[model samples]
Target chain A: MTLGEQLTETSDALLELILAAEDIEQKEKLREQFDVITESIEKLVKENVKKNSKEYIAVTHNLNAANQSIKEAIDDLDKIAATIMQVAKVVEMLGKMAAAMP
Target chain B: MIKKITVLTLSLIISGCGLSVTQREAATRFASASTSVGDFSAKEFAAMRDVTIQMNTKDIALGGKAKINDLDGAFDVDDVAIRINAAIALSAYGDLLLALVDDRQSRDLRNATMQFEDSLRGVSGRTLSDADLDNLGALVYNIGGFFLEQQRAKALKQIVLRSKTDVDHLCDLLIQDFNPTGLNLLHAVDNTSKRLKVDADMALAAHKDNPKSKLFAIQAYRLADSQRTRVKKTGAQAIAVLTALKSANAELVNALENNSEFLVDTRLLGVKMKNLGLALKVFSGS
Candidate 1:
């Protein structure tokens, strides 16, 4: 699946989990993370298309190679499709887990 | 038992012998070895020995400017620099013993290591004085002696010695003792995750209906972010702890991102996660 499609699916899975959340406060906080995930994806698909160019892809790839000079470039938020995924994973782990969710 | 007593008694007596017969011998050997370079005399060695002992004993006994001045005298004056360097290490040996002995019982091995390290730095350009560099040799002996006396210091020293080949092995050794002996990484992970659940509950209470509340988001984010940041910092520290002060060989960010201490220090997670809201606060100039 495309990165956007994959992210949307993860978002849906997390939202469905959130809906079952018994704690009203948990529901609200999950709603915020849910909003963050949606907003980040929206930012990617809308305002950041030029950022998805091969130049940005190279930055994330550069991190894997230990190009010491490019550490700052690697930190560029738009360059990190993989990191978005990884952070989504952290959110699922920290904010929502399949095993813990009803 | 008798041998242990003999060894302990001998170590104790040698610790007290002051001026150290062995150090005096080393100074004589150093002087003879370097005579081709200069005629280093026993008097110079004795002068260094006296000054270094007085300086360090005072340093250990009190500490601060008085200590710094004592070393500065040896540092600033000429000709005796080499002898003074060895003497500093020798003098520090007495302090080490005072800390180790039963009544004294202070365990600042790091301080002892640093003093010897300074002496080693000061002596770098010169050969041992005619007295066989007795003071330096005796200092090396005492450092090695602590290997037998203190497990943590010895393990740390060994980690440095062994890190050339197996750095992960060094980290593994740290994991064994960093907590109590039996409670380790696996336990740390399970316990922290469970505790995170409780923190999550608290965050739920604290964050409910408080989207606009600056304090609430900061608290929640800090609670969440601490786990990640602490793990990263300690992983960096473990790598750094092994490295010489000037060197930066440890690319330990990933290890910190991945490790156990991060899990235990979970309070900061909330602080860090608040980064997003804090950034928003800044952008809005609030």
Candidate 2:
């Protein structure tokens, strides 16, 4: 591979190895850079016509999921807590009234 | 009158709804068990001890030269001596024995007493048969250091070994071996996995952008995930049971958020609670 192509592969590989990157937009920028380099090289090699397809699809899916799941988990935790308190309020009123009768 | 009832009802509702797993258990137990250790008193503890002392003294009397059988229940051998001799077991037999040396008591003093009584317990409890006692008697009467040299050291070693055995048995009683509420043990694994995952995340956050540390964090995350996968799913049928418990005792005026966990679970308490009911399964700490 040419020096530019090697540098591109190294960057993409480094990017893939990082887990749960907090900023998906930052990752996408780095990823798009890697893709441009890969697209240029594959055209030169006359490799598969679907050059940047596989990795391009994966990074897109990951970027979307990471952005979505973090917010979802936080919201889900809050919802579970709110439901618990609501249940508690209902039961407490019923039980206390029953407990107090002559 | 209705206003008073409404306030009381509301207060109970808050307590019932907010009580934690441990306190709830204690409340249930308080409703059921006896008020105190009426039968587990010092005298009863002492009598069981007298039987032990009797056997020890009996050995000393029978073995040959001097027949000293004047071993009445003279347990006034000092209170500290009593505590050591009680040798209160943790789980029948455990590997690590916790000695109760009161803060006021000196370390050497407690150790000396523990070693002495532990020897007495071992000799009386095992190995020294009638014939052995007859021989031991001759040695105790005629020889100096007979109690300390052979009997005491042999007994200490034996007691230490027994204490180790006790610790092992107690460790086996760790509640997580089986699910706290069922035949399955997944609850323990779930709690463990969650704690590990949190720790891994914290470690990763601390390490931040370093590649090596991040790799370690990824490995830690995988380990935590593996721990989670080891557990099967939980069944929430017990939630109703807990709900029923909350309803039953959910009355009272004060709402305490801090001690909520202590309020909900069924546990054996070492000492009685400051306030109690008629039924509780108050288990000793040991």
- Every candidate's DockQ is 0.01, 0.01
Model 2 agreement with the true structure over B81-176: per-residue lDDT tens digits: 322222222211111111110111123223433343333334423433444433332222222222112222232233333233222221222111
Candidate 1, residue B216: the lDDT equals 42
Least accurate 10 contiguous residues by lDDT in model 2 chain B: B95-104
What TM-score does candidate 2 get on C-alpha atoms? 0.19
CA deviation > 4 Å runs, candidate 1: A1-102, B1-172, B175-198, B205-207, B210-220, B243-286
The C-alpha stretches of model 2 lying farther than 4 A from their native spots are: A1-102, B1-24, B27-38, B41-44, B64-77, B80-259, B262-265, B268-286
For model 1, residues A9-101, the per-residue Cα lDDT tens digits are 666565566646777677666756665654455344323223222222332233222222122222231123233334333433432232344
- State the lDDT of candidate 1 residue by residue for B1-286, as single tens digits: 4344445644754553322333222222222222211121223234323433443333232211123434422222432343233223222322322222221111223334344334433543343342333343333334333333343222222322323222222223233212211122211221222223333434445457766543543443343234333333332332232221112112121112222122211222223324423432333321
- Residue A44 shift from truth in candidate 2, angstroms: 88
